[model samples]
Target chain A: MASIELKDIVKIYKDRKRGTELLSIDNVSFSVDSNEFLCLLGPSGCGKSTLLNMIAGFESATSGTVSVGGKPVLGPGADRGMVFQQATLMPWLPVWENIAFSLKLAGKGAEERRAAAQPFIDMVKLTGFENHYPAELSGGMAQRVGIARALLLNFSVILMDEPFAALDAQTKLEMQEELVAIWQRHQGTVVFVTHSVDEALVLGSQIAVMTHRPGRIRELIKLDLPRPRDSTSAEFNEYKRHILALIREESALARADAATV
Target chain B: MNWLASLREQRDRLWVPVLLIVAWEIFSRSGWLPPSLLPAPSTVCRTWADWVFSIDESSQANAGRWIHDALASSVRVFVGYAIAVVSGVLLGVAIGWWRWVEKTIEPTIQMLRPVPPVSWIPLAIIWFGIANKPAIFLVFLGAFFPVLMNAIHGVKTVDRNLIRAAAMMGGREAQILRYVVLPAALPSIFAGLRIAIGSAWMLTVTAEMVAVKSGLGYVLWDSYYFLRYDLVIAAMISIGLLGFLTDWLIKLLMSRILHWQHGQTVQGRNH
Candidate 1:
């Protein structure tokens, strides 16, 4: 059974100043099999994040349904964990508290929360920094805390919206590797959103390429490349080229459409 | 080496106060102005010591009344500031969180905010009589707005994503508000609290001058009538010191609560 199903999702944003309705995601639909690492790859403003938000229940579909494990999403719940691009860990919370934040909300005692947060903290390699606040952390470390917090939620599905996009190249690569390892061990459904084709290829079992505004799924490319996929390999290059071409074509069409308007 | 660096920093900070004192001493000794009108720093210190220690009756009725006056003023400040902190934070959070509260309450508060707290003295006096009640009421009026404004701002400006993140972790509305909203708003609330403390002292003194008759402001005013400029100067210095002490106390509390913000000093970190 699919872990997440989005049936004909439509999201229209009212632009009151422009006197028009902007269709951000138009008739988008997809399904993620249990434990599948799916990436929604698109250009900026293509509603990839919007689609992820819908699945995460951070957003409501204008005219469609989103279900996780056959349960329709009513609002943001513990069944779906989300990691934001900005690593939105509460600035006032220390690393351990952030990781165990969900448990805290659930009224778990301090010791239980601390004990539960430990493994994920170790998984994210932020063990010693558990007492440090988010402000004291480096960007990469903060993002690690974000990931740990999501993992601690122990949700069946984790949604990430460009989680590593703000990091430097080295940090992004390192995080990508750590993410794959974490996901492999956890085996949970992941709906990742990103603009980077290479990032999609590295982390996703399936990459859903999306077109520009009034976003529609252009292609859902299933990648069967083996684990620890080599970025420099010919297969990786071929996939990257195909994805890049798809994005460029969409961008060109969007530009032409803008010009006509 | 770190101690030396900190001492150097301390010296840089002390320069302004030192210069001001020296300049005041020079002006008072120059005799351009009447000595009675402008007491020298040394004379003021002597009067202050007498007021505090009761070494002599140089300040007459106010001699040794320093402790009582300081305590009375501080008590009013504490009561008023405490009420302001609690109510301001609660109401601010409510206004920020609930649209109905914001619409109904915030506009009225904002309208009242522009009128000076001092301007409410006559009304406060009439309502509460010439006692601590009037002083405290004035202090509350003065201090509440800053705390309320900051708390509201803090809650409103909390990163929306953090709330979403909390909700994702099985947080109910109350849980989200407590664990997420309140903690997230602490830094801003602290900023408001600091600002309110300053206003708290200002209003306390103003209240003592007019509505109340037992604090440092009362002593200052009473001394002026007696033509005891030295006592007036002493009272002024006492108020200044107390104000500084209260502000420092607030800063200490803020640092303790917001120690998380130390390394994130890039923006919105400093009070």
Candidate 2:
């Protein structure tokens, strides 16, 4: 069964300066099966994050519906955990406390919350740094905290919006591997949004290529690659070349369309 | 040796005040200005000691009444400031959090804000009848706006993403406000508190001089009527010292609560 579903979604944003309504996402629809890792691949200005946000119930579609766990998403709820592009941790809270924020909100006592946060903290590999604030953490460590915070809530679906986009190349690669390992062990549906072709190819079991503006799903490519998918592998490169071509074609079309206008 | 090292460390903060006092004392003795009109720091100190200790009774009626007057002003400052802090923070959070609160309450608040708190002395007198109530009211009026404005700004500027994250974690609105919004807005609120405190002391003095019978401002005004400039200067110094002391106390509290901000902000970078 699908763990998450979007039906005939359309999003329109108001350009207050121009006093005009701009179409952001038009007639986007897709579903992710339980435990399926779905990567949304697109260029900047495409509503990839917007689409993920709609699933997380941070944003609502101008029309159509977003459903998770067989219920329509009215607003943001614990049922759909999200890791933002930026860590967005409560700077005032220490690592353990930030990880246990949901429990704190649920009225759990400090001891109980701390106890619960321990496993997730260890899972995210943030062991000794649990007392540290978000400001003290490096970009990669902070992102790990964000992931742990989401995972602690035990949401069946986790949505990520270019979570490692700000990290250096080395850190990003390590985090990507760690994320895949965690996903394999925990087995949850993930909707990861990214503008990177390589990131999409490296992580996604199913890659949904999106168009530039008024974002529509151009194609959904399924990957049957083996565990620990190598970026240098021939199959991975083939998938990368194909997705790159699709993105290149979309960008060319966007440029041509702009020229005419 | 330790005291010497500490004094050396404090040299940057100490030099200006020391220089000003020494120059003022020399100028007062040099007769550049009448000693009575601009009493020397030494004269003020002597008068202040007499007022506090009743040494030679030079401060006359105010001698040995210093503690009583200082306590009265301190109480008024504390009560009025406490009320302002509570009401301002609550109203501010409400104004910042809800559009309805902002739309309905903020306009009237903004309208009242620009009207000087000192101008309320007549109305304060008429309403509360030359008592502590009028002085307290004035203090509230003076301190309330800064706390309210800062609270609103702080709440409004709390990272939107943090709220979104909390909401996603199934946090109720009230819980989010308490756990997320309040802590995030604290630095701004404290900033407001500091400014409001300064205003609090100013209003207290202004009120004491006109509406209330006791306090440092009353002593200042009464001494001026008696033509006792030394006692008047002493009263001024007392008020200034009290204001500085209270502000320093707040800074200490701010440091304790917002220790998380240390090394995270530009102000905290030196340490």
Candidate 3:
């Protein structure tokens, strides 16, 4: 059985100001087996984050089902951990306290929460800055705390919504490498959403390309490329080129649709 | 040199007040105004010292009664403000968090908020019988709305994503409110409490002037009846100083409890 599944999902948002119903996701369906790192890649407004949110139970589908580990997702639960686009750490909590927040919720004592969070804190390379508040950390360091917050939960599925989209290029590359290494050690299903083709190519075991607004899965490409993916190599460039072409065609069709309307 | 430089800075800030007091003394002694009607700052200071130290009978029946009156007012402010803090925060959080609470309770509160607290004086006397109860009731009326309104705004404006983050972690609703919502809303709640504290003192004195007769406000009003304008001015100065002290104390507590906010806010950055 798949670790996470979404079948025939359709989401229509009520735009109250415009007095209209807009379709954001249309008949999208996919599943991820346990231990699969599936990246849902597309342009902005593709409803990929919406799909991820549905799986995480932050939102419900207007029609159809989202289930994890053979059970339907009714609402957000500890079974699926999520890392948001912005590092939404409580501004009032220090780094370690933020990482140990779930433990705190679980009624763990301060000593235990500190001990439990240390490994994940160290795993994310934020060892010495434990006492620094969210406001004190840089963007990259704060995002690491966010990642650690999710990773410490030991959930069956992890959903990420453009978790590193705001980082500088060097930090993004470094974080991507660190994330893959951490995922290897602590294997679980991951569904990452991103607008960057290179990011998807680098991180995903299976890349699901999504079409623009009224989003649908356009294609699913599996990568057998060796680990430590070399973006400069021919095989990597070939996959990047193909994904770029697909995105170009999708945008061209979108422009045509606009013109006709 | 460091202490000297700091003293210079302090002196710069004191000049305006010093000049105002000097001018007032000159005008009062010039006999342009009746000394009995508008005593000089020097006369007021002498009466205040006598009232505090019982050095002489210049302040008459109120001499050495300054501490008693000040404490009485402070107690009223404290009791009423405490009740306001507890109930206002509880109700405000409930209104902010649940639609049912907001719908049922908030409208009535909004209607009641506009009625002047002073206007409640007659009702307060009839209801609580012109004792500490009436004075405390008046203070509660003055302090409650600020605490309630700011708390509602604070809870309402908490980052939606933070709640989502907490919910995603399997935190139950109560846990989310206690650990997430309450802490997130605290900075705003503190802001309300500061405003409420000022109102608490104002209403306490107002109540003492009319409904009750023990605090600094009573001293001022009673001294007026005896035509001791010096004692009246002394009472006014006492209320002002006490209000300043309470506000400073709250600011100290805020800095400690919200230590995490130390470098985050624009105000914090300046300090």
- TM-score of chain A considered alone, across all candidate predictions: 0.97, 0.98, 0.97
Give the C-alpha miss distance for residue A36 in model 1, angstroms. Answer: 1.1
CAPRI classification of candidate 3: high
Q: What residue pairs are clashing in model 1?
A: none
Q: Which of 2 and 3 is the better model by TM-score?
A: 3
Task: Sort the candidates on DockQ, descending order.
Answer: 3, 2, 1
Which sections of candidate 1 miss by over 4 Å?
A248-261, B1-34, B266-271
Q: Clashes in model 2: which pairs?
A: none
Candidate 2 residue-wise lDDT, B162-268, digit = tens: 99999999999999999999999999999999999999999999999999899999999999998899988888889999999999999999988998887799967
Clashes of each: 0, 0, 0
lDDT for B36 in candidate 2 is 89
* Models ranked on lDDT: 2, 3, 1
Model 2 TM-score, 2 decimals: 0.96
State the displacement of the C-alpha of residue B116, model 1, in Å, after optimal TM-score superposition: 1.7
> Which has the better TM-score: candidate 1, or candidate 2?
2
lDDT of 1 by residue, B200-271 (tens): 988998898898889999998888888889888888888989999988887888788877788677533554
Report the poorest 10 consecutive residues by lDDT, candidate 1 chain B.
B262-271
